[model samples]
Structure formats: structure tokens, C-alpha cells
Target: MRKNSMKNMRINEEVHRELSNIIRSEIKDPRINPMTSVVAVEVAPDLKSAKAYISVLGDEKSQKDTLAGLTSAEGYIRRELAKSVNLRNTPQIRFIMDQSIEYGVNMSKMIDDVCEQDESKAKSREE
Candidate 1:
């Protein structure tokens, strides 16, 4: 009775794979940067709509441009996905920017800084 069953997981993975391929090789939108990639996809239970998480590796301007490009190309992307993936209904695509990778890197840098400071303090204490 659950919608988030194994079937949904397969569909989500296939959709994510197809989308990543389409965005990387097929899409010609000037707004889409080369660094843009599909991070994940979540399809609704009814399969009427799906949310795609995209990671843009660049400055803020490029990220915005890539999002704009993806938003504009939603229809075409859906059509391509439908053609590539066999499903009863093609889900509407919604592009969302994912910045988790950046956040993680920032956090790692902060942690490293703290560790370095602690090491320096230990050295000074010894001296």
C-alpha cells in the first residue's frame, strides 16, 4: 500500500539516470552550464510530477543561469525522458538547486581550521 516501495525506487533511479544523461549530452540550452549535474530525483506517488535536484559547480551567477536553463527546458526534458523511459505517465519535471556538496566542503574546511588551531595551541603549550 505504500507508494515509496521498491518499484518507486527503481523508477526514481531510472529517471535520475536518464535525466543526468539528457542534461549532460542532449540539452543545448545556453543557460545550462557544463558543470551542472542531476544530483537526485524524487517522483510523486501518482507519478504526475517529480522533483530533480541539480548540483551546479560554479559561482552563484552560473548556478542561477543553469537553474533558469533547466526550468525553461522542462518540457523538452520530459519528452526526452518519456521517449527514453517507458512509463504510463510522464511526470512533470521540477528543477531544484542542491548545494549539499558545497556545504559539506565548507564544513570540512571549518573543522580542519579548528583542528589546526588546536594543534598550534598544543605546540605553544609545550614550548
Candidate 2:
């Protein structure tokens, strides 16, 4: 299957949804923060391997710990995936730390600060 083929896209979406559900409700590792989320998932067209992008809403330590927990539980997760999704071959999952959400929040805060500062300066000038 081609990378962006309709079938491939459907597979990716199904995998992404199932992964989110599995992480949210199945895993009970303490190292994984409750605030952890599966941001995205990419399954290879051949379905031999996959990459799961995870985002943790916590400190650096928590993020690292969550990633480690997920890494260690790969086999279990893969098994669960196989059970839940009827695919010819279940992809081997690789956990990846995704910082895009955090980066976007930080950038938003900075923009708001700048806007506030600009407004304050305008008010002062008007006084």
C-alpha cells in the first residue's frame, strides 16, 4: 500500500484511535502520568512497524518517565492492539515524545504577554 493511500489513511486513523483508548483506559503504570495523551500515530504501509507520538502534560521528569513506561510495556500494548484491531499484522510500536502541543501553548502565552504589554503601553501613552 502507498503511504497516503485511502486504505493506509484508514489504517492510520484506526490505529490512532485504538492507541488513544488503550493508553487512556488499559495501562495502569504509575510512571505514566494520568495527563498523558497519544497525540498521533503513524503506521507503515506494510504494517510491520508504527510510531506513536505521545504528549505528557507535566514536568520533564514525568514526560521522561511516561515514555519509559510506554517503552517497557510495548509488548503488552502490541498484544492489546492485536486483540482489539483485526489486522493481518500488528505493527511494532515505537513511542516518541511529541512536544508540539507544549510548544504551541508556550508560543500562545508569549503572544498574549506581548499583546498585553502593547496594550499597557498604549494606555500609558493615552494618559
Candidate 3:
């Protein structure tokens, strides 16, 4: 498959789906929480490497635990992914913690606070 080809996109999606399933159903590591989710997947042009972005809905400790579980289960996850996708070469899986969701929420809260303050200031000025 060419770099960034349609096939690559499809492969990324497939990997993402299969990896999520594998993580959810197959792996039984205690470190991994059920709240974990696959946020995104990025595959290399050669299809030899895949990075899975995972979001853990908990504190920092739980997030670290989930990542640790994923990191240790990389071999099994890759094997399952290959079998599930029927790929000639199984891409090495890498787990990364994704915090974009939390960041967005925090940013939204800050914007709301600023807006409320601005409205109060405007009201005071009018008064």
C-alpha cells in the first residue's frame, strides 16, 4: 500500500477497531480498566508500526495503570490484531495516553468563566 493511501486509512481503522476489541475482551490485565477507550490510531507508511491512542477516564494513577497494562500486552494485542485483520505482517503496537478530551473540557470551563466575568463587568459598567 502506498503511504497515506486509502488502503492505509482502512487499515488504520481496522487496526483501531480490532485493537479496541482485543483490549476490551481479550486482555485481562488488572491494570487495564474497563473505562479505557481507543481514541485514535496512527499507522506507519510501511504498516510495520501502529500507535494506539487510548483515553482512560480516571485519575492519573488509573491512566498510568491502563498504559502499563497495554504496554505489557503489546505482543498479545499485535498477534490478535494480525489474526483479526489477516495482515501479512503484524504491526508493532504502541500505546499512548490521550488527554485531549480532558484538555478540551478544561479549556471550555475556562472560557465559560471568562465569559461570565466579562458579562458581569459589562453589567457593572452599564450600571
Estimate the TM-score of every prediction: 0.93, 0.98, 0.87
Which candidate model has the greater lDDT, 1 or 3?
A: 1
Q: In model 2, which range of ten residues has the least summed lDDT?
A: 1-10
Tell me the number of clashing residue pairs for each predicted model. 0, 0, 0
Off by over 4 Å in 2: none
C-alpha RMSD in Å of predicted model 2 compared with the true structure:
0.6
lDDT, model 1, position 33: 93
Number of clashes found in candidate 3: 0
- In TM-score terms, candidate 2 sits at 0.98
Candidates in order have lDDT scores of 0.93, 0.94, 0.89
lDDT of each residue in 11-109, candidate 1, tens digit only: 999999999999999999988999888889999878899999999989999999999999998989999999999999999998999999889988999
* Runs with alpha carbons beyond 4 Å of true place in candidate 3: 122-127
- Give candidate 1's whole-model lDDT: 0.93
lDDT tens readout by residue for model 2, 1-127: 7898999889989999999998889999999999999888899989999999999999999999999999999999999999999999999999999999999999999999999999999999999
Q: After superposition, how far is residue 74 of candidate 2 from its true place, in Å?
A: 0.6
| Model number with the top lDDT | 2
Give, for candidate 1, the lowest lDDT window spanning 10 residues. 1-10
* Residue 67 shift from truth in candidate 3, angstroms: 0.6
